[model samples]
Structures are given as structure tokens and as C-alpha cells.
Target chain A: MNEVADLMVVLMAMTNLILLGTARLTLGVRLVGAQGALAGAYMFAANAEHPTVHVLALSALIIVAKGLVFPKVLLRTLEKAEARHEMEPYVPYSASILLGMVMLASSVWVSSRLPIAGLTIPPSAVPISIWTMFTGLFLVVARRAALTQVFGYLVLENGIYVFGAAIAGEMPFLVEMGALLDVFVAVFVMGVAVFHISREFEHMDTDRLSVLRD
Target chain B: MTMYEYSCLPVVFGLTLAPFFLGIINRTKAKVAGRQGQPLLQAYFDLWKLLHKGAVYSRTTTGIFILGPVVGLAAIVAVLGLTPFAGCPPLFSFIGDLILFAGLLGVMRFATMIAALDTGSSFEGMGASREAWFSSLAEPVLWLSFAVLARLTGQFSLGAIQSEIGSALWAASAPELALTALSLFAVFLAENARIPVDDPNTHLELTMIHEVMVLDHSGPDFAFIQYAAALKHWVLASLLAGVIAPVHTGHAWIDITAALLTMAGIAVATGLVESVMARLRLTRVPQLLVGAGALGVMAFIVDIMR
Candidate 1:
């Protein structure tokens, strides 16, 4: 069981590296969806010994909200914005990938230093989740596309959920449901904001969105 | 599988099989383009024809012009002697012989570049400059790959390193091995002047890297250069094969055969790549080479972590 979870965590890290190197906004969104799906699978696999009805229900909700709904909204945002590729990135794609490896190494080092007690999953799980969250923030900060930033936010949420699932076997059902609803509403609002920005500016490069600063 | 320490096998195998790789690649490319390709023995025939022809020299050139092909051919053949095939050891091995192998390749490149400059032809000079620049970036990637293997196997010589990476190492550190193989593949493609980095068939001298430097040579000199080019490709492919597909059948002869087949498969793969993808922009070539360096670095990191 631990072996299966370890494989999933490694795969999620690989997907994060791919996301950092990818140039197409659409492909990045799809990879994020796949990562979300893997996170849901991790939840199911980690609680294999005793999967309660609430745990199963929460996993389903995660898969639907993260793997399906968020990506669809982002893809529609991409279509409406007419932005297929990310241009004028803050850093080169290759450099971002190297940076991601660096981030992964640092996360591993940091995870080793901070010992966790009563951990349900592998000790590496927390680091993997932290690394995924760091990668998401990197995408949000480095990419110029607004849709990519939204995808990054979703990845950040997925990492938080992974941490929650690994440490606390099951959160309260109402709290989990509330968290899911909040994510959906946040993505919904972000999608609308992206639609309006594209309509007003005729392009989706958020790097140039600082004209009103003066 | 038992390791056999031997000599003379790589020399005999290299001389016989090097030209066949070129033939296989050309035929594969031709068949892919819907043309009736030349026979698999076409490269052998071309080498024969060139060997018998009279040589020509320009009045502006010096003795180094004649010395280039000879030195290049000897260096390549020497590198071949230093490489191990299958599970058998190389004809020669030393504690730091891998470094010597790299140095010999550098000498070959230096010989060719100086010879190109000796012609006083601006076009050859341009090719030489490009070759020097790209190789400066590529050489480190090659060494970094060697460093990873050396660190993993705890051996500095090529023969020992190749012999050390048995099934146990593969099972233990598969990711690092895969990364090293990828880095070596990139180095092989760049070093051989293959498509994506260079187009051997492109007649436009302005775009040529390896071929342009030899434009002034003809007859026997040209033949030496051509043979040396094939041998260099063979040697590099052998090195790559040793990493990516190390065959250990417990018999030296069978292992040698498996290694040879693996190299032929690589030739076919290269032809397929050429058929599907266009050459990268010259400016983008460094990025690809640097990506290879990145793979080497990642492999080193993975090895350390393991």
C-alpha cells in the first residue's frame, strides 16, 4: 500500500516538472487536471485499509471539482481568451524546469529536517505536497498567461488537499464539503475575471496588466 | 555473464561494420521517402572507389592539409580500440583512459579544424568556427555523463565502467541510468553531425558543418575523411549502446553480436528522426545541447540521492 502511494507521489512530481517545462497553456491545464486526478487517487489509496463512506464521498467530490470541473472552466477560459500558447514568460521554459528540480531537492531536504509524528503515509508525502504547492506558485509567478495562473491556483489547492489527506485521514465532512465549494466558487470567479480581461484588453498576457498602477 | 578481457575484436568489428551503419541509415531514409534505395553495401563500394583514385591538392595548402585525414582516421580508430563492446573488455584500458578517449576526440576535432583553416577558404573557416563552438558546449555534457557513470560504478576507465553496470545496478538505479543514456544519445547525435544538429545531405555549403570542412579534399584524402567519419559514428554509437543496452549473455561472442545489432537499431532510429523532424534553427542548437547538459546534471543528482 505504501509502495503504491510512493509511486503516485513520484508521478505527481514528474507531472509537475512537465508542467514547468510546457509552453502551451492548454497542455498545462490538462496536466494540472491529471495531477488533480492523481491526488484523488492518492486519497483513495492512502485510506485503503478502512475507506469510510465519507472518505469515498470526499474523494469523488475532489475528482469532480478538481479533475473535471476546474479544467473545463480553464479550457473554456482559454478558448474565450484565444490564448493557446504562453508567450513572454518571466523565465525560459528550460530554466523553469531546472528551477523545479532545484525546488524539489530543497523540498526533500526541508522535509527531512522537519520530522512529523503520527504520520499516516510515507514521510516523503509532506515534502511531495509542499513541492507541488511550490511548483504551482512558480507557475503563477513565472507564467504570463492568466489562465495558467488559474491552473496554478488549482494545483496549489490540490497540494493542500494532498497534505490534508496524508496527515489527517479524514477531515469533518461539512468542512471538506465547504472547502470544495469554496474552490469551485473561486475558480468560477477567476474564470469570469479572465473572460472580462480578455474582452477588455484583446489579449491574455497578465504581465502587461499593470498599466493602471500609475 | 562473465567478463572477457580481449583485444583485436573491436578493430576487426569496427572496420567491417562502420560503413554498414551509414548504408543502413541512407537506405532507411530513401525507403521512407518512397525511393528505391541503394544497396546496403553501397558505402563499402564508395569507400573502395575513393581509395583507388588519385589525389589532388591546392597550391595554397601546406603539409597539414595532407596530415589532417591521416591523423583524424588514426584518432578515431584508436578511440574504437579503447571502447568495450557487449560484455567484453576494451582492447586497451587504464585508470583514466576515458579521459584519454575524450582527449583523442578533441585532437581529431582540432586536426580537422586546423586543416580547414589551412585551406584559407572562408566557408570552411565558418564551418570550423561553428564546430568548435558547439563542441565546446557538447564536450562538457559528454564528460558529465561519464562522471555520472564513474560515480555510480566507481570506476574511471571505460571498460571497467561498462562492465560494472550489470543487472543489479540497473535494478537499483534505473532512473539515473536512463538519464545518462539520454544524455549520451544527444552527445552521439551532436558529435556525428547528424540531422537536427547538422544535415549531412545538405549541399548548401553555408549550412554544412562536417562536410563543408572537407570540401577541398578529394580522392584518397576524401576517402580517409569519409572512413574516419563513419568510424567516429561507430565508436560513439558503441559508447551509447554500452550505456542504453548493455547486453550480457554470459558468452562474449553473443554479447558482441547483440551490441552490434543495438548500434544498427540506433542508426535506423536516427534515420526515422531525420525523416520526421526538420533541422533546428542554428540559434536554437545551443539550447538543445544545454538540455543535454541538464540531463547529465539531473542524472548526477539522482545518483547521489540514491
Candidate 2:
């Protein structure tokens, strides 16, 4: 269980960094979906035996919602809008990757201090998950295109799922489902937002995303 | 009364006092600028006036226009339930209550922005965009700042942090807290249509974002939306005060006094700032918010080191 959790944590972290460093919006969305499925697997593998119905349901939902539904919608939005690549990133790929590494290390060190290990899951899950969450936020800030930011949001949601997994028993079935659906819907709505944005501006660069001023 | 009873007061106080705060701030600005302001309770009167009247609808508006203020108020009330104003009596407490507290605020902004879009006017659209942009930056600052409080005292309840932050043990660390407090003050100004970020009196549609968006709203619905905006502003201001005030575990009177004083101080500060500073150009606003994020990050690092 420990080794598998470690691998899941590492894999998710790498995917997060890759999401940051990538310029291709399509691949970024796909990778976010992959990260989601990986997280679901981690939850299932970490607590397969005691598998409460809610746990299984949540894990399955994550795989479908985060892994599948979100990415598909984002890509479709990009496809329709004719904006598929991240152009003029605020931070270059190399720097974002390096910063991501630092964030991962810091997250691990930070998570180690918390008693998540004393809970049902491995301690690494919390920090790695938090690291991924903030990295997603970083991606949102660094990337210029609205299409690419969908990936950033997915990665953040993925991190939250990982954190929730650490304290799975503490949350109720409906609450977990609600949170999951909220993320899914928020992303879905954001996809619609990208469409409207493109309609108005003819481009979806983060710089241009700034039609709102003080 | 017990702590829970004391905590209840702040929540009730929160609901009751938001409009009055707006009244007070407007009066201050008027007095300072050498004009006789409306009565301090004029906001309450405006609410009464608007509510008694009917709404005038725009041809382009949709359901979102109606939903914006309703959801905004709901979100603020939801958030107040999570915060521990006087005695840490949050209606809902959890391990990561702080996150929920901030998240609810984000949700409010999210709803209102979309609601702004529902108006279908380019002016409203522009306001929504700026609100979204500034708020995206503001939310992270909010999260990181509260996370520092969580780490510093090793507590997560919004109320507990308020109380713990009140304790004398942390009082010596003024520099970081002051910076956090100041930056949060900036966020409160930006979030509210306060001066130096937004001029409530502005009639210029081309340059105005917040005012221009609501140009078409009137009567009762406009009143609710405006009141919600005031409540939202008060929530941010009070929370920032909690960051600076020794709100935790003090005499209920002491904590409440400090908190209210902080609120008044925030209003006065807003007026002073409006008097002294000019609103940054539209593009320049993000840099100011980024500076806020920088402060939050700095404070988080400071908390982690401590």
C-alpha cells in the first residue's frame, strides 16, 4: 500500500509539472484526465479492502468526471473556438518545470509534517496533492491561453481529490459527490466561458483575457 | 454568556451592520470632502426605498441578472456562518474551515461574474471580466494568507484562528501581520467598490467597470444587490481585522471591540485612501493585485519559518 501510494504520488506530481511545461492545450487536457484516473486508482488501491460504497462511488466518479468528462469538454471547446495551443506563456517551460520541482519538494516536506499518514492513507498523498493543486494554479497564471487554463483547473481539482482521499472516511457520500460534481460543472462552465471569450475577443490569450480593468 | 453565545452575536451583527457600515463610510467621505452626507443609516433607508419600489428590467438581461445579487448575499451569509467573529461560534466548523471560508467568497464572485454576463451589455461584460481577473488574483492571496494563520497557531477553524490570533503570544510579530492586514485591506477595497480602486459615484461608462455594469438595475433588486455588495465588503474588512486583531480567547467585549474598531478603521482608511490616491489605470490594477499575492506568499513563508 505504501509503495503504491508513493508511486501514485510521484506520477501525479510529474503529470502536474508536465501540465505546466506543456504548450499544447489538447495534450494538457488529456494529461489532466490521466492524472485524475491515476488518483482514482490510488484511492482504490490504498483502501480496497474496507471499500465502503461511498468510497467506491467517489473513486469511480473521480475517474469519470475528472479523468474523462472535464478533458473532453475542454478539448471540444478548444476545437470549436479554433484555439488549441498555449501562446506567449508568462513563464517559459523550463522555468515552470523547475519551479514545479521546487513546489513538489516543498509540498512533500510540508505534508510530512501533517499526520495524514496516521490517517487511512500514506502521508505523501497530502503534500503531493497540494503540490499538484497549486501547480495547477501556477499553470493558470503562467499560461496565456484560456484553453490551456482548463488543464490548470483540472490539475487543481485532481489535487483536491487526492487530499480528500487522505481523509476519506471523514466526508459523507453526498458531500464528496457534490464537491466532485461542482468541480466538473465548474470546468464545464469554464469551457463555455472560453467559447464566449473567443466570440468577443477573437483570441483567448490571458493577456487579452484582461478586458476587465480596475 | 458563553463563547458560543458570543460568537452568535458577531454573525447577527454581521447581517445587521453591513448596511450601516456603508452608511458610515459614505458619511465620512462626504464630511471629509466638505459636503453634508446623508444620514449614517442612509443605506438602510435606501434599501427600504428600493425594496418598496419595483424593478425596471433591461431588454437584454436574463435570469442571471436577478440571480446575481441573490447568490451574492447567499454566499456572504454562507461565509459568515463559517467565520468565528467574536467567540469562534461558526455554525459549521471543519478541519479546513478556512479554505471553505475563502472558497465561499470565490464562489460568490464566480456567481456574480456570470450574473454580470447575464446582463448581455458590453459594459457589464467588462466589469465581470475585471472582477474575475482581480478576484482570481485576490482568491489566492486570501487562501495563502489564511493558510499562514492556520500554520502559525496550528488551528483551522476561522473562529479559532481569530481567537488564537488574539492571544498575546503572536502580538510581537507585528511586521508580518501588519503587512498581511494592509494587503487584505487592499483586497477589501478592490472587492468593494471603494475609492482608489473604484469610484461609486462615477457616471462615465467607458472607464467605469463596477458602476457601469449595474447602470440598468433599479428599484428593489438593485437595492438587494447593492446591500449584498456592502455586506461582502464588510465581510472582507472584518476578516482582515481578524488578521490584525487579537481576536482569539480574549474577553468577548475586547475581541468584539477590536473587530468593530478595525471595521471602522477600514472604512476610515478607505476614505483616506480615496482622498489620497488615484485609481490605478485599468491595466495597472493586476500589478497591484500581484503585489498582494506577493505579500501573501511572503507571509506564508514567514509563518512556515516561524
Top candidate, metric lDDT? 1
In model 2, residue pairs whose N, Cα or C atoms come closer than 3 Å (at least 3 residues apart or on different chains), thus clashing, are A144-A206, A212-B130, B162-B248, B163-B248, B166-B246, B166-B247
Error of 2 at B219 (Å): 1.6
lDDT of 1 by residue, A153-205 (tens): 88888888887877777889899889889989999999999999889889878
Model 2, total clashes? 6
Segments of candidate 1 deviating more than 4 angstroms: A1-18, A33-76, A116-131, A154-192, B1-6
TM-score of chain B of 1: 0.97
Per-residue lDDT of candidate 2, residues B1-306 (tens digit): 377756567678888998888877777788888999889998888899999998887787788788877787788888877766655567777787877778788887877778778878788888888777777766776776776667676787776776667546355444457557757877787777676667887888777767776676788768877877887877787787777655554477776776788788778777777767787777656656665655555455434433
Scored against the true structure, residue B261 in model 1 reaches a CA lDDT of 88
| DockQ (CA atoms), all models | 0.27, 0.02
| TM-score for chain B considered on its own, for each of the candidates | 0.97, 0.92
Model 1 Cα lDDT, one tens digit per residue, B230-299: 9988998888888888877687778888888899899998888888888877876776777777678766
